[model samples]
Target: MSANFKVLTEDSQFQSELSEAGGRLVVADFTSARCGPCQRIAPLFEEMANKFPTAVFLKIDVNQCTSAAASQGVSATPTFIFYRNKTKLDTLQGADPETLEARIRQHYGDGEGEEIEDSGVPGHIDLIPMINKAGCECLNESDDHPFIQALTSAGGYLESDTDEQLILYLSFNQAVKLHSMKVKGPAENGPKDMKLFINQPHTIDFDSAESANAVQEIALTAKDLEGELIPLKYVKLQNVMNLTVFVKNNQNDSETTQISYIQIIGSPVQTTKMSDFKRVTGKKGESH
Candidate 1:
């Protein structure tokens, strides 16, 4: 089911019906027109409204709904609240699209489908946790970067594909640890050989320190998604440049194989094991 909800500046139904919307999967945005944060989250809230039509979604302008804000304990503008069966499942303050989607997936459930065998599908990493969909389109070709609550929400999967290439524009201050890349072989449904690179200023030349996290190269045979991380003691990962990968299909066919499309996810997801580095059965585009 799909839905579109338009919450006006002054609506009396919210207070009386808030509890009615409880436990039914609701994403409420407490916003104000004057506040920049409120406006920024508006499109994202509505986008989610469309994606999860089965869920109740609405927005309350803090400036107009003073009573509602007070009743809901909204002390700030653009505070996102998720209610499942009228019970508060999650909350985000000063959040972005990606932040909202992540929260939704955490309390609601991952939109990133089930695990498959070595199908060669790639995985994604949401480098910026604060922005729900910051890395949302690392390598996505799902109808362009239109704002979808699932894509812009707190913790929604950005893009889902078997062959993908990701490019991330980062802020050194916020990124903590982001070494998980999604990739897969043609036969393997999971992700495979994943790589990361950084672009920094030439004055800050860093070399021969892999542990320092210049960048990380990771590979996987199966989906162990969460475990010990590949060490960054010698890599030196401060100044970033670019990140790229070739999730090619080397399958033994008479014709060549070239990727037609790609999808990059925003957050770190675990749907498969393998990676994007290994050779594929479809070596169609070997020349490229």
Candidate 2:
């Protein structure tokens, strides 16, 4: 076993390892001493442990830790499970070396592995500098924890004043192709059940935002609140000049929604102007 690989003998140890993993990818191998396939793949598993230093590699002997195996539904030996942010991503049975390596690469590759699907849109940048600060407003937000603080300053946060809901209206200096957004806060109070609108002429209220059609709606998970970039609908946000984010509720149904940090990721769109086009006169010709 490599230095990164750990052999778990107790259920408590298994749970502790997962808790410590936090947002990192964890690959757990459930095997038995008697399993022939497990022995064959042990070398490759150790190699992967060494290769992917950022990930957590764990081995749990089913016979030694029966409770741990049962909790993870590892009825068959040589079962491999992948987890991230305390969520089960995938499970693979049998010890096919090719399949095992592919699964590892899919989650955490050598250099190019990514959790988000490739949106094909390029030139993504932080759009904070382009924000029209004067045009931005957050309804139902506490005065102490203002919207500007959460949007601009580090470690600053915004909290709801009245209820769990919050409505944020933000306009930009130029049109942008919005790719994704990141919202960070406490898992319990972080925004969930979010609705996004684009190019709204006026600030949206709770009732109107709920009834009106939204470009996209998302139910945020705990992992999402951990500063993960949530991808937006590329087609709908291609030409967005203004954006409205509505927090319909929060995780755990908290009394107030709170956001510590928010980042908009996309590229600015360059529109053509009629003035840029010059009318060319035909050179003085003898005949038309």
Candidate 3:
């Protein structure tokens, strides 16, 4: 029961450490100090490590420990890997919090071998949803995005097993890429900025210039939103119902023109009124 982090120098050392992990769990976080996305999610894994102190928590710096990283096939920062009884269970290659969390949950389950925790939702954050509905009027963006019927609440969601994409053609005062993709969220007086979390579960406020988000910050108006805007952009999804898309009015704004509705239509991506979403989904007059 140790949340210990060790830097491996060679493949043999890494193997020895893995075997030493016993029957507990091994969480290998392959990261470097220079990775912005790694910095964003480092806190999340830290929190999980802390939450389950009985496991082996390691932070392998890919830059310094070349041999170990190369052996593990880790060329990127913030790669989370799992091993049970020295056997690899799951591997998360990107900085996608939702995807990472999903993989971790799958590996950890309720307990490792014998230990058990009664907490229903273990080591996962509850993020608000932006578009909370089932079967949006918007057409299916990917084979992954589907209407989740067993959710505690229905919303625009993608199954954890799916690597699908959904494009949200909405207008924001500012738009930036989380890593390299173009995505938009509430800017100006719209809503609180999304947080970049990892091990310790931290948040980068809308105004803060943090090491999170690898790509340069660009201003994407309605015209800038291209490709499929993933639901994972909003929530750190693990389960099908884990994705949330809720937009509440900013209390500080005096303008009555908050977000009336969230719509996705037309080429590339288009921002339409909420009425269209409700009319299309037959959810008119209902609040998210």
Candidate 4:
């Protein structure tokens, strides 16, 4: 329960990590030490812990922590449960590594899947509410192509009817350090070049994007468009308030462009919790 991956022997430790602060995603594996499938999937599960550095990975032995397993409705060995902000998102039973990995990437990003030491996983804070058109022009800007749709729904997307480029302005509710980003869409019509301008003016246009000083410009490949986590230069994205992404063009010289999903992974510059607040008294001298 202390490391990125941990064994939960008691119910107390299990509950504590489940409710840990800062809106983290927790993945719990319920297994019996004696089960053959449980034994088989152990290494793959551990590899997932390393792959998802930002998620809390827990392996609970049903025999050791019976209360925890029963409370979570785990009746079978090698069951997996995903939780974020104390709410259950999804669950998987048995030791299917492909399904498990896909589920993890669905909630998190698809970073380099290699198993490495946990430097840490970036927080996946939903930023759809903070988006603004700024200076964007799209031929199809109706509800069908709502910009916010691309940020959340994996199946939903925003498309440009007039041209191949689309611009979006993201102003976070709080400052965040961007670690990585994932883009998902059709292969041929997917983005090829993306330019990021940090804390820039909202009046940025297609022409302005060419002249404006770019913090980073990424030459995206097919792998990136298919939901791979493209890690950004970490140092350049510290304390970011507003970000601008200018999609230059698509892989194919298509007249229209499509983006099914866009995900940002980062941590807030300062996280304020309601539990940390206390009422202040104005009339201390007159109060009884």
Q: By lDDT, who's the top model here? A: 2
**Clashes in candidate 4: how many?**
2
Cα misplacement distance, residue 40 of candidate 3 (Å): 1.6
* Each prediction's number of clashing residue pairs: 91, 0, 27, 2
Model 3 CA deviation exceeding 4 Å by range: 1-13, 112-288
Q: Choose 3 or 4, whichever is better by lDDT.
A: 4
Residue 125 error, candidate 2, Å: 0.1
lDDT of each: 0.43, 0.77, 0.40, 0.69
- Which residue runs does candidate 2 get wrong by more than 4 Å? 1-122, 271-288
Worst 10 residues of 1 by lDDT: 113-122
Q: Is candidate 2 or 3 superior in lDDT?
A: 2
TM-score of each: 0.36, 0.52, 0.36, 0.53
Candidate 4: stretches off by over 4 Å = 1-11, 14-143, 271-288
Q: What is the lDDT for 189 in model 2?
A: 89
lDDT of 3: 0.40
Cα displacement (angstroms), candidate 4, residue 150, comes to 0.2
